[model samples]
Target: MRNVKVIVQGGPANEEVRTLPAHKKNPEVGDKKTVFSSHLLMEQADAESFGDNEEITAMDWGNAFVRNKKTNPATGKIESLDLELHLEGDFKKTSKKVHWLSAPTDAHPLIPVVLIDYDYLINKKKIEDGDDFTACLNPVTEYRVNALADANVEHLKRFDIIQFERKGFYICQGTKDAEGRMEFGFIPE
Candidate 1:
């Protein structure tokens, strides 16, 4: 299986961040000689959006390594571990970038949030003069996804607009409730 790389956000402010330097001579070897972290924290969710897909390089002393499982041929049981070199610069050729949210902790509690999206009220994009608009109305118009936002989301007020990375912009539906959960409606691009 190919390894996966993730860009993590939304956790404690004091969390560890690492950087690595790309090889100077060969621009293709790394990330165009751009300086970035060699050590990246491997994050997991309470319920992973994808299973066994995020196990790429794991966190350790300044070096990123992928764990390759060795299994016995006779019994098919796992036998040993093999480590493979995976650097931040190697992302161009082998890595798939996935976005993740770090788990909530007491130091940086996450704000519960619901993101709602809507289908077109009228299915047709443009209606001709003789077309019946009511017949084209969409019955199911809303889709909601429960998510956790960074602690800073507490500062958001009703009707405030915020951009969710890779998810587009959202408008705050209302203020946080007693349980510290709020709702946002997706704004189409």
Candidate 2:
């Protein structure tokens, strides 16, 4: 049970909103989670930024409900509300430092990326050009590039969530994809 406050400016913006309860639990497998939320304050100029064929990046704000709150019919009492929290944008343009992969060669330039997942965190050495990586719907809160390389995987297993600095908060999906890749998602905060 954590509390989060969010504010957005320079776009379809809103005044500061406060005291929202973040109570939703992370969603399980096969769940269609709402990964992004916020009051979209799109101005004509902002809308126009998305020119016919180009991709435009923008910061978005919204609340994330990890799980839905439901009441027990028999007890006539509210059981638990789904985990929810405030989320702010963490995309490359809005982030203070953009994340990129160093070129395989020492002299080549680096390449920028929009999303990264657990596989990148666990096995940075094995990532190849065609490897598919996936992240949780929620953003991660904290992470280090070589966490597993330095620590015991079993010891870190107890925590359900991890914060990826400059990335976002992530919750483990506890499942693997068709290619046996670990799947996780982020909830921006």
Candidate 3:
């Protein structure tokens, strides 16, 4: 038989969809995905050792954009974007970054704000206001209570998920309820 020539080609491998603990039931399909957009608040601080040497020179607060994708919309989809929350203007004079949580409750909306301090840095970090940073918002569902409980127990690190009738990615930050129930303050993105 006559000799035949063959060729091989390489291309980007297709990645399998990852399932987060939240979205384990009814996964989002096709173009049906949650798109979140919101204005975020950020702060910046100074870099120094202990003593009076530590001081904030600038402060800034501005709006930012946060985005994330939902591979499976069944269990729960938390925010997975890693964007620096920048603080400029008056904020720089005080601390680093701060995040707030907003959510609706039986009585009213739960809004809790927290101040984020820069404990340490690597390679002289650089950030600015009006700069966009990605953040995760937890989705609101029946599982929220359990999730928050786990979070309070330290079983979960951060509660970054958002759930609204139309909105997406939101986080929960604040104290527990009278029954030791954890409430979420969703930062819309």
Best by lDDT: 1
User: Tens digits of per-residue lDDT for model 1 on 48-108?
Assistant: 2222333332322222233444445996544333333344434434343443333444654
- For each candidate, the alpha-carbon lDDT, in order, equals 0.49, 0.30, 0.28
Q: Please report the TM-score between candidate 2 and the true structure.
A: 0.22
TM-score ranking from best candidate downward: 1, 2, 3
Q: In model 2, what is the error at residue 126, expressed in angstroms?
A: 47
lDDT per residue (tens digit) for residues 9-119 in model 2: 232222232321232353332222112222222222223223232223332233232233234589544433322232443334321221111112232221211223432
Per-residue alpha-carbon lDDT of candidate 3 for residues 1-189, written as tens digits (9 for 90 to 100): 011111101111321122233343445621222111122111111111112322222111232222222222573322222223223335435443332221123332323322221222222244456543332222332233222111112222356443422234445454555555445554533
Q: Which is better, 1 or 2, measured by TM-score?
A: 1
Q: In candidate 2, how many Å is residue 8 off?
A: 36
User: RMSD per prediction, one decimal?
Assistant: 10.6, 21.5, 24.6
Shift of residue 19 alpha carbon in model 2, Å: 37
